[model samples]
Each structure stands twice: as structure tokens, then as C-alpha cells.
Target: MIKLYGMTGSGNCWKPAVLMKQLGQPFEWTEINTLKGETRTPEFLALNANGRVPLLIVNGRKLAESNAMLCYLADGTDYFPADRWQRAKILEWMFFEQYSHEPYIATVRFWVHFMQKQEEWKDKIAEAMKKGHAALGVMEQQLQKTSFLAGARYSIADIALYAYTHVAHEGGYDLNAYPAINDWMKRLEAQPKFEKMTG
Candidate 1:
């Protein structure tokens, strides 16, 4: 059986859970509370040197990194395209989500919602908001032209961005400003077997 170790509230962790459900893959989930320093423990470190949640253990092989796990799970499936260029395009958006979008958007969400350090991290939050909005603007532009990030079809690229983008309001981002993104989100939610984040 496949096993996942993660906090349900984390968007990164929630990514694979939603995908697994959508793909009809059965798995066991074990919650690890990072806020309580569970991830820093030696046992957790042995599974992931980076000491992060969203670790996937399959047949004794452990995989770290949510996006990497997504690629692994979605490979050869409709979520990952068969066409070389189309796959590359999906990867492009996935990479952008990690580098440009997650840093600011997810970070602020972590700070404001999880840590409740909005005042303590005011300066940092302000900076993240600016950069996060910029990332959203980029997404808005692409979403304006295409139904999905890679193209008309939904892919892991959409899943990657949707994980954080949907709950961006937790970080104080206003979705009302991005009509295309809102529409795309609605479209994604309308997908069959779609699951909401657990926490």
C-alpha cells in the first residue's frame, strides 16, 4: 500500500491527496505536525533529509517534494501529457509555481494563517504580497488565453498552481481582481472526482 506523511492543512501536502483521490489510487495518510516540531525528529529525518511533510512511501522507496511526487504519480496518466512538448509545457508551469508563485503566496499563507504572525511578519508579508501579486498577474495573463495553464486540457500544471492559488485569500490576495483565474478555478473544481483540501 502507498503511504503519505503530511499535515492535512498544508497546500503542498494537500496536492498529492487530491490527485491520488482523483486518480482513484488508494493510500494511507499519517499526519505530521510541523508546528509541533514533528518533522525535525530523527525518524522523520531518516525518511526525508529536508525534513518536510508530504513524503510519499511506496514499496519502501521514499519520495520527497510534492511536485516530484505529482510527476511520479501522474506519469503515463492523463494528468501528465504524452506529447513531449506538451509535457515540457506542463513542467514549465510547475517550475514557475515552485519558484515564482509558491515562495511568496504559500509563504504568506503559512505566516498569516498557520503561524498567525501577520503583525510579526508584516514587512515580510508586504514584500511577499507584492511578489505574489506579480506571480498572480503572470498567471492571469496565461489563464486569459488558455483554459488551463499548459493548454485547454487540465493537467498537473493546473493542480500545482491550484493548490495554493485557490486559498490565496488566506494570504490576503484578492481573487476578485483576476477574473480569468476565478473562471479557471471554477472549471477545475468542476472536474470529476475533485476533492477539497482536508484542512
Candidate 2:
């Protein structure tokens, strides 16, 4: 059986769990409390040198990085796609999520929601929100042209971006302006076997 080690409310950790559920693949979950420093322990560090959650153990081999897990689990599945160009496009959005989107959106959410730094770190949060909104604008532009992030069909690219975006409000982001993104999110939520992330 596949084993996943992750924190309950983390969007990065939720990515693979959602995919596995959609695929009807049963897996064991081991909760890691990042707030309690569980990820930094020697045992956890031995499994993943980076000391991050969302670690996967499959057939005795361990895999780290949430996006990498998505790609691995979705390979040859409709989520990953077979066309080279389509795959490339999917990867394009995945990379964009990690670099442009998650850093701003997810980090701010962590700071404001998890750390309760809304007032304490107001200035820093404001700056990050600018970049987060920029990323949302890019997503909105593409979503206006395509039904999904990569193209007409839903893919891991959507999963990658959706993880943080749906909960962007927690980071004090106003999604009311992005009509296209809202619609796309509704479409994604309606997919078969789709599971909502748990807190």
C-alpha cells in the first residue's frame, strides 16, 4: 500500500491525497504536524533530507515534493495526458504554480491564517498579496481562454494551482474580481471522484 506523510490542512499535502482519491487508489496517511516540528525530527529528516511534509512511501522507496508526487501518480492517467505538447503545457502551469503562485499565495496564507500574523505582519503580507494577485491575474487570463489551466481538459496543472487558490481568501486575497477563476473552480469541483481538502 502507498503511504503518505503530511499535515492535515496543508494544500501542498492535499494535492497528492486528492489525486489518489480521484484515481480510486487507496493509501495510508501518516499525519505530520509541522507546527510541532515533526518534520525536523531526525527520523523524518532521514526519510526526507529537506524536512518537508507530503512525503510518499511507495514500495519502500520514498518520494518528496508534492508536485513530483502528482506527476508520478498521474502518469499515463488522464490527469497527466499523452500528447507531448499537452504534457508540456501541464508542466508549464505546474512550474508556474510552484514559482509564481504558491510562494505568494500559500506563504501569505501560512503567515496570516496559521501564524496569526495578520496585524503583526501587515506590511509583509501586503507586499506578498501584490505578487499573489499578479499570479491570479495570469490564471484569470488563461482561464478566460481555456476551460482548464492547460487547455480544454482538466489536468494536474489545475490540481497544482487549485490547491492554494481555492483557499486564497484565508490569506486575505479577494477573489471576487476573477470571474473566470471562480467559474473554473466550480468546474473543477464538479469532477468525478473529486474530494475536497480537509482541515
Q: Which candidate is the best by TM-score?
A: 2
lDDT of 1 by residue, 11-103 (tens): 899899899999999999999999999999999999999999899999999999999999999999999968999999999999999999999
Query: Looking at candidate 2, what is the lDDT of residue 68?
Result: 97
Deviation in Å, model 2, residue 76 alpha carbon? 0.9
Each candidate structure's TM-score, on Cα atoms with residue i matched to residue i, is 0.98, 0.99
Residue-wise C-alpha lDDT for candidate 2, range 35-146, written one tens digit per residue: 9999999999999999998999999999999999999999999999889999999999999999999999999999988999999999999999999999999999999999
Q: What lDDT score goes with residue 48 in model 1?
A: 95
Cα distance off (Å), candidate 2, residue 44? 0.1
lDDT of 2: 0.96
Q: Candidate 1: minimum summed lDDT over ten consecutive residues — where?
A: 190-199
- For every candidate in turn, the CA RMSD to the true structure comes to 0.8, 0.5
